[model samples]
Target: MATFLRENASELGVRYVIWQGRIWSRGAGDQGGWGRPYDGGGVYDPSDATGGHYDHVHVSVRR
Candidate 1:
């Protein structure tokens, strides 16, 4: 994800902040149909990608 962000940072105006086991947006906020404090956890998959229980990325974009 870091590589992807670096490649499109300028074009997409991407910005981020990391805290409390989650990443937050410095710019984009609750605009992708997702509400603030998006918690990326649901069904637990043992063989899921990221080699973790959840197959999603946690992102919080608001205070």
Candidate 2:
């Protein structure tokens, strides 16, 4: 689901996306497409299964 939007962000007017806690913006750098490692502010963690897109996905679209 997230991959679809990311691959087609321009055509879909996607401004931002927050899923599983990680965030992605239109102009943001690659940076692994996830949050920082130390802050615990991101959604993905190898040791933690509860972090990443397991529950839901949040998307911000442009008007």
Candidate 3:
């Protein structure tokens, strides 16, 4: 989960983390929280859970 990755990002070599349409880089302090509209305020639709990644999460690692 986001909390775990954020706590161990440095040690785990995490480069980025994405969940619910919001992104968090290793050092980017929560990115000011998720669910902010983008691209004409339609990038994320709260009711549909379609634009945002409400179902799954994505993680990236450093090589």
Indicate which candidate wins on lDDT. Answer: 2
What ranking of all candidate models by TM-score puts the best one first?
2, 3, 1
TM-score of 2: 0.62
Candidate 2: which stretches are off by over 4 Å? Answer: 33-54
Local accuracy of candidate 3 as per-residue lDDT tens digits, 1-63: 866876688999988766666766754554356423222135556344544555666567888
TM-scores for the candidates? 0.25, 0.62, 0.61
List runs of model 3 lying over 4 Å from the truth: 29-31, 34-51
* CA lDDT scores, all candidates in order: 0.41, 0.63, 0.61
Residue 19: error of model 3 in Å?
Answer: 0.7
Q: Which ten residues in a row have the lowest lDDT in candidate 3?
A: 34-43
lDDT of 2: 0.63
Estimate the overall C-alpha local distance difference test score of candidate 3. 0.61
Q: How far off is residue 12 in model 3, in Å?
A: 0.5
For model 3 the TM-score comes to 0.61
**Which of candidates 2 and 3 reaches a greater TM-score?**
2
Distance (Å) between predicted and true CA of 58, model 1?
5.8
